[model samples]
Target: MSVLDTRCVNQLYLTLSNILSISESDLRQYVIDKKFELLDIAWSEIDIDEFFKTVKSNVNRLKGNIIESVTISHLSSRLEYECNKENIYNLYSALTGETKLRKYLSDVGIECIHESDVISVFFHGERIDWKQYEQTPVVLMLQKRLGVTSSGDKCINGFLFSGDIHKNMNVTHIARIPEFLENLLRILKVHEAIYFWERNAQPYEIIFKEKFSGIIYDGDDSLSLEDKNIKTIKHCISFLGRNLFNEWNQNDNPIIRLKDDNDVLADQIISSRNLKTNRIIFK
Candidate 1:
């Protein structure tokens, strides 16, 4: 193998076991000159799974103490153990990998992951020190995967009670509430909310403030916090469909929906939508 090529692959985190044997100075120069070109090449060659494996290997092997380890399953371990069998499976499937366990995503179809899910893999693994890993473009992308990094600042773990449920809420239970109204409210902390009847939404459609982004998931089979949230949201939507249709069949009057105003995201979304008596509304 070319010394040039092996060094590039090494920088990409493909294999860390001395794929190249150049000296420290030569190694640094090799990376400085050629790493970016290799990164662009590798990005197209590798699937996300292999890329994740490379990340884990490098993190475990890194020589310093700057990696801040975080994973929803690990962070919210107790929450999963305390839940139901299906719930536990849902949680397990989310953290481990969802493409293996579930065949169909209920009403929308299995292909709906891109449409239904949001912010998948929030806070992937840990808050890695950019200074330590920035030598490699792959690691740079890993940091980006964890979140958007500004200049100079070291990345750190973030926590909050609400706002961007994609980044905050660690449980799937809230997502299972109909129209995702309840979970929506908890994230945004608004007093009112609305749910648009799209299969899965592009965040641009919900535009309001700094709280906006569009289509944040990559539709991987791997389990993630976003998977739990999406699955729960779908179940909740199905429940609403059944309950509302059934009640309408019996009484033939307009259905009055009940909701908790305390959920911030839900309130903002609902308040944004203007609903007439018989039709679904989209804002």
Candidate 2:
């Protein structure tokens, strides 16, 4: 079985505890001590700093406390154990954090299944080739650094990244980018490129720097506000609630492209894999 590091365990514990309102001490008592046994590791094998830092970062990020109450209830219904908070916490944390827990739970007649990974992120309308860049610094920045700020159904394997070839611009908005990046990716489920134009940036260009790139449009008077594209942009604003719209629109950044002129943009979205044809089909 693959061993989870202390950092991963802490992330799992803190995330589940925050969502379910179960304290860490309770988690240790009811789950770690009684339900499943964890393998001991040497001190030198663990990054002690990362272990504590992850715990601290999880605490800070959860300060917002935005995980909806209804979500917890819905998750409780799907659990295999008693619906009480402690059992629910153990069930969910085990499913996510420990492979050993799966075997133990299965022995007790709980159905434990693993879901296939979903490529939930897209760059410049393409699926990210994560394997090729596993050792690259971009992976560290985008995955490790950005992950500290990510929320909602957090999983290590859910995101994807792809984009244009311009890898030289300074990504000044990395912090703000994560706030709306996941929502923008979900919007791409039914649409293509979500273009945001800044008054200072060039028109119809995908700017790439700091290992990321995205299509941008300049909301200039020369480009009439009455244009259909502009109307579509507004439609997107109205469609995606005010909070998400404001997140993307802050600091003069306005969405300029969602679907292309001929609706060819969705073709770039990876919706289905046609194995017989050896091609990816879009939404």
TM-score (C-alpha, index-matched) for candidate 2 = 0.16
lDDT of 2: 0.27
Report per-prediction Cα RMSD to one decimal: 25.2, 25.2
lDDT of 1 by residue, 1-283 (tens): 2111111223212212222222434433433443444333422232334422432323322222111111111011111112112221222233234532222122212121211222122122432244543344544443333233422111111111112222223322323332222322323233222232223222111111111111112232243434422332222222223333332121111111111111112222311111112121332
Model 1, TM vs. native: 0.17
Compute the lDDT of residue 71 as modeled in candidate 1.
Answer: 13
* Pairs with backbone N, CA or C atoms under 3 Å apart (clashes), candidate 2: 123-162, 169-209, 197-217
For TM-score, the strongest prediction is 1
* lDDT by residue (tens digit), candidate 2, 94-126: 444454434433343333232332212334445
Where does model 2 exceed 4 Å of error? 1-126, 141-176, 179-283
Against the unseen true structure, what C-alpha lDDT does each candidate score? Answer: 0.24, 0.27
Candidate 2: minimum summed lDDT over ten consecutive residues — where?
69-78
